[model samples]
Target: MRAVTANALCAGQTRPGSGGRTRVLRLLLTLCALTALFAPATPARAADTTPAQAADTAPPSQAAYFADRLRENPVYVTDQLPREVPRATAPDFARIAKKTGVPTYVLVLPMQSSTGGKELLGAVHDRLGRDGLYVLIEGTDVAQATAYGVRAPADAAATVALYELPYDAGPLRSFERFAEVIAQGGEKAADRAEAARAKSEDDEPAEMYIGPSDRSNQSLLTGTLLTGVPLLIMLSAGYVRRRRRRSGAERRLPRWVVPGTAALTATAIALTAPVVFDQTRSSAARTPSPADLSARVERVAAGLKQDPVYADPESPRVLDARQVDRLHDRIRDFRRSDGGGPVYVSLVPQTPESESAGDPDLFAAAVHAKVGVDGVYVVADPADGTIDVYNHGLRLDSNHLFLDLPDSVAYGDSKADRADDHLLGERLDALMTFLDETPRTDRPGSESAPAPAPRAADEHTLPPLFATDFWPGLFVGAFLALLLSGIAAGLTWIVGALLRRRSATPQSPASAPASASASVSASNLRRTAHAELTSLIGEFTEPSNDEPDDHGEHGRAWDCLDAAMLLVEGDPGRTRERDTDPATLVTVIVLARAGRAALAGEATEQCCGVNPLHGPAVGRRHVRVSREGNRRRMLPVCDPCRDTAVAEPGGIPDRLLKLPGLESGGSRLPYYEATDGPLSAVPDGIARLIDKVRETAGVH
Candidate 1:
């Protein structure tokens, strides 16, 4: 049959649609035959039996008939049976019993493949001897299987099965049901047994239970409550001190220095106090044993082992002792690690328990030993009953480390009266002391030890660059250079301006006589010149009668006189030399005055008698001059004669007007012969001279 099945499977692969149909037909035929072989028989006599007979007589026997068929068939007995079925003997049962701690009631059903008919009977004997509840049964029997909702052929291999019993009972109840079902020979028999068991136990309740006192809970409370008070006090004190310091700084210090110095001092006091106190506390605390640490390690290991995260088959978690050792080693290093340098450390309680203890000593010590440095600190984890170690490195003057231990360690508790308040204060004090005193080289021995020699100075040093001397000097030098440069530039500009002004201004000539004065003579020649010029030019007409003739001869004469007066005004540049040309100016003035006197109907002889060309007359009288070789010879004339000459209608002779060298036509005189010429001739000469003067003055 196997060879035919293999050949047909091969044929199905070789041929497409036809072979697949043939294979399906073959499968159907095989299924039908197996179904027929395992089919249950209907009892013919059971239907015919009367209710009274059914109750009295045993049910018609399908089991016996099936047993007869199985015994009759050699193939069923040999090929269908297991080569080595499990036994219900003492040793075999004991082995299974040790592996699973369940009682025999639960064990017997799963051990049914060894003995076919006598298995249950033998199991009952073994279990009864051991004081167990029941024996094994045909776990796959029709009635037994149907009760548990499982189905298998009578000759099928035995298999273990589980079921959720009624009333939420466990595996023990299911096993008891299996055993009772087979013994009582009915589906409802196991239910009766379960009911009886439940009833027997119902009167008594399970024992009331209590668990052990929590050591971690006590530790937590002690740690927190003890530390909280001191921590609060210390923080409060520090805060008050800072306030005092700030007030002091404001009152005492200069405006510029207040901010920096006050901040620095406050921060220094705050940060340093806690670290120093922590150090002292750490030294004071008791040290725990290595055995205690080992136990803790084991507990942690056990927790990790039970967690599915670590036990999962696909991805397992791993840990090593070295990693733990390194962590402790780092902490130990921190306990000893310190310097009077900028960096400092502080310890604060991190949980209510830690704060309650009023001491960080134990925690600090553990962290110190673990980290090997004084900078290491311990804080508590409130969520998990564990202490956290911290390694803090901050500038020595930082307020960040001046934490209130109670506040810091009490999770989120902000209350002042927490149990761990005192611990916070104490820890702060210890931390401050530690920070103040601990040396730089004193760290964990396990870590790379600091070199013996102090650190070498590099090629560059920051100190000099930021030194007090350097900045002040640099600033002073820069300021002086800038100030002096500005001053010098300004001075140079002023000096240059002065020199330019001096060079541009005109200077008096060095050769000029300083004390020399020139003589000026007053004369009436200008009047005569004015009169002549006005008669020749005629009178000017005005556009309006109210408007005077501003452009007339008199106006012209006034303007000229005013211009001359301006030249004589006190100008710094004007000098006596410019105004002292007496001969020409006096002649012009005298002629102008003479002409004005003539026009005013004054005696012509009196006005014309004053000649600026001649000196003052002898005896306070007038002097007459006659032309002689281009020079004038003076003749003594009486005052009446001068007056008569001025009063006459034609005061001067016309021949006198034609005086030699004074006439408009050319004329000359002999020096010897003209010594004492006529008065008329001299008068005419004077008039002509005056007319010549007026013409030269640009009057007419």
Candidate 2:
């Protein structure tokens, strides 16, 4: 047999130009429909009832308008099997809804799959418009129960899950128990909420009305500004004063530091100033009392019926024409009352232009004004999934009828972001339950009694960021701050290192010939000193394979050589001018090597190659042009000569002219230049010839 699927059957029926195969499928479908008509209900929930469970070609689409659904008992039941929805159940569903104030819906049928059932549920909710706990059934136990536009006190799914009915009992028995739980549970929950709220409010004194006052505000502003401004100024001024008091502190904070500090401080004051002022003054005295509020409700009542729905320009219903239509249909069901005057409903979204607590109150009053009796006003923000309800003319202190907006009506796995029809329906159910618990006692003059003053805004300040339990926001903020601090510290270190390197390495202005030349000369001088020191140190450390000097430090006196080298390197500070400059350090090493040679009874050559002790030689650093003291010089100075030189200061000694690295000044101040003699002073008679040559050449 060529089997035909349910979708194929539906398509064939909807499309035109049927072929022979279509005709055959239609005939087969008709026969199956007839068989279903005579057949008993599908097998129990335990069995996999197929063939019999084939999709119903004739889907009982419950997508008609809500008004149409209301024309009946607000309950509709249809099945794939031609059995009727027990005539007794439909009217009872209506009676219970009217009596208990909880809307009820029931469906009995064979489902093709969960997907199809969910679609059917959605369709039914849209068509009916009234929120109710709906139980879906097939053979025995409840298949599923969903609250559509209604949150029943007893969770439908949970109740069904806990049912204890036996298999032998008909499914109706279990369903009856489920409905009872819904109606009763809803009533009890409402009672509990009302009692709790009343108990909490009983201890409070009548609230006072406090309003914002400008005189107080101006005074506070002036006082804080006076106090805070001076403190900030003092803080900044103190920094300058301290800097000045310090012997060598910088004259000013970096330009950015002062401005940044001011900005940070100003921001803190700006943030806290308002809050501090607000806390000091009391505004409870200015708040409206119940009587005052009741009068206010009457004032707005004139415009109540003018617009049934005071929709904001950005209202969800305005944006989606179809949704408005759906809402209208659902409201129509509630409009049909049992003589206590028909109720009107208002739907308003939270928008900037809309009344803030229209929030929930404005719409409820508006609904009551229009209907002139019981009414419900719902304020919702679809954007954030919040729903608040306000009821007018409820029999009890209508304050309890008001519901705080819940953050989410529908929840799904992580990906979900908005409420679904089921959640909306459940919310509506909660509204119905509250009304059922206590129908209007006072007519409310177009509104519910003074709602337990919507929690004073400031009374419930935002919770601290660091809570005793946990705060994910604080955790995330701290992590980010630490990460940024680490990055900033790393960047600071790198930048400082670069700056030090650049400064220590003297810059040669590539554009300036004089600066560049001077830089080159200094570099060459350091290099030469380094080369000389290295050679001197190596001369002692490394042995000559050929011979030993008079000092008996043979080709190899490894121990003495090591000792001399260690002393020079470790105490280079002995002769270096700065102890750190490379050139001065090299000089220190050379002096150490020379001093050691002198101690070994070996002839030591002076850096300047002049020794007065060797007769007429420039001799020691003390009397030579180097002009160093005895302790600081590599060679000793005789007391008599030092005294004579100090007492009779001559310009320059002829014998002290061949200092290494010295220059002659032709004209510029103290200018000195290298002479033609070997870097050492002229030997015994050699100086006489150099002098004669200088005199011949007319040199000074």
**Number of the top candidate by lDDT?**
2
Q: What TM-score does model 1 achieve against the real structure? A: 0.14
- Candidate 1: list runs displaced more than 4 Å: 1-388, 391-413, 417-472, 475-479, 510-700
What would the per-residue lDDT of candidate 2 be over residues 564-606, giving only the tens digit for each residue?
2343444422323323333233222333334334334443333
How does each model score on TM-score?
Answer: 0.14, 0.23
- In order, the Cα lDDT scores of the candidates are 0.31, 0.40
lDDT score, candidate 1: 0.31
- Tell me the lDDT of model 2 at 155: 50
Q: In each prediction, how many residue pairs overlap at the backbone (N, C-alpha, C within less than 3 A)?
A: 117, 37
Model 1 C-alpha lDDT per residue in residues 1-700, reported as the tens digit of each score = 9777755654444345687787786786677566566655334344344344533432223223233332342111110001111221223333333332223322222222222434333333332333322223322221122111222121111111122233223223333334434444333444554554565455432212211122223333333323333333344344444443422211222444534543564455445433432211101112222342223223223433332111111011111223223333443444445433221222221221121122333433433343433333434322121223234442233222333323333333334224322233333334435444433344331222222221112101122212334334434544554555456556866996797577445222111111111111122223323333343224222235564444554443333333223322422122224333323333333333333333333313222222322221222333323322223334322343345345651322211211121221222222112222112222233355444444444545
